[model samples]
Target: MSAVLISVAELQELLDTAGSRVRLLDVRWLLGDPDGPQHYLDGHIPGAVFVDLETELADPPSAAKGRHPLPDLAHLQKCARSWGVSDGDTVVAYDANGGMAAARAWWLLRWGGVADVRILDGGLPAWEKAGGKIVSGEEPDPEPGTVVLTPGHMPTVDADGAGGWQGLLLDARAGERYRGEVEPIDPRAGHIPGAVSAPTAENLTDTGHFKPIEELRARFAGLGSGPVAVYCGSGVTAAHQIAALATVGIDATLYPGSWSQWSNDPKRPAATGTEPA
Candidate 1:
């Protein structure tokens, strides 16, 4: 019952009692395997709709904007309605890749002004393990939603803002990437200067559910006391970091351009190695 996460049992209750008001989004995506729609077609929650992170969730990429810039607000509104979301609907997003990808939908919907959005804790694996029903093939799209959306509901920072940020800037990429051990898809390796490495994978337990609240609190203790901003390779898993911080009662801003945009700009200095120098 975390503010940003919903348990499988809680989702089941809502489905049983408030079915008409619940909007389920299956946001299945993985870094190398991004064929989300086809994977969703193979199996999904009974009423969940698929959200494509590449197309629906993000704008087309460019050097200045990073790999997954926030979708334009108007486009996001259109997409939300297509998912059958209404102003007051309870939106739940889940993915097979822990909550890594689904958290993007959760963050976007909230930023677009949908209140009460939650990530299904442990995602699909949790659902099935709890004996929750699963169905294959696309469910008929729900009636087009009437949800009205506004941008900037959640905090965000652009490259310049991230560069000058005085708060704790958390780099939510893998430690190896943060250390510049691999370049992968970006123009360079290494993390934003002065940002701390807090990989999103550590947020989960072996069972894939988020760890207990106290444990999370202890994990982040003393990282910083000021405002927090987070970023990952392309701003996707960063949402997962924000979600984890949320469960720990920390409000964080998202750096949408993240490392992708930062690395591409030759003007921006890339700092490698362990120290956040």
Candidate 2:
């Protein structure tokens, strides 16, 4: 199977037998908070290693970049190996915020050519609610290995590329952010001209679980032609959009730099107001 998602029950069943072959990652993170590691130390899924989204998964912030810039490929590969993930391992990632953080790691693994990966449905809360096992302690020593970087699988596009391509530029930020009405996170508030606002939250239900695959397909029906290009503030929440697209068999490329990168460049045109420019 191609990284088939396993529920809490399924994960429990596979725990002992698949210990070595299955790599469980806790990708819980908060946007501007620094207590993720402390929370993980309090408790996490048994045998799961914690992966910090900012320090481990993304590069340092730059003046012209989003808060969570894409990490170096080699560095990511090293982090993968630390969690006991190999090319052949079945990696599963999860986070507290539904699948937002987890999906980012999932997408990154696929981008790195580690195709056998999946997100824990509903994340840690779901697992805990389902009476899954938990462990409290620090992480064990990782068996590190070199990861081969394959950039081809990780498709990305800039504002110019998004404009030129026939594919849909799906903005996954909130309606307010997309409309450039209230600028809270980034210095500028607005979206790329001609991009459609398809908020990532639309893909989830009131309980934080993802919507049904059929519903997702219906929602994104006339967005565009060819592959969709998913973007959001700094490309984090955008992964949730890609996950939704993938659930419905729609393969979309990610603009990793996303709005943070686009807005920083004065040369790039940003569209404000409700209408898609």
Best by lDDT: 1
Candidate 2, residues 1-277, lDDT tens digits: the string is 1243556777777776777778889888867778888888899997788998988889998757677788998788778878878777778899888798888998888888987788887788889899887788897865764456576586887667876657678889999999998878777889888889998888887767787767878999966666689899998989878877887787888888888888888888889988779
Residues 1-277, candidate 1: write the lDDT tens digits: 7979999999999999999999999999998995788888888999999988899999999998999999998898998999999989999999987899999999998888899999999999999999998899979978999999988889999999998889899898999999999988999999888988888899899988888899888877757668899999999999998998999899999999999999999999888898888
Pull out the clashing pairs in model 1: none
Cα displacement (Å) at residue 12, model 1? 0.5
Lowest lDDT sum, 10 consecutive residues, model 1, at: 216-225
User: Candidates' lDDT values, in order?
Assistant: 0.91, 0.81
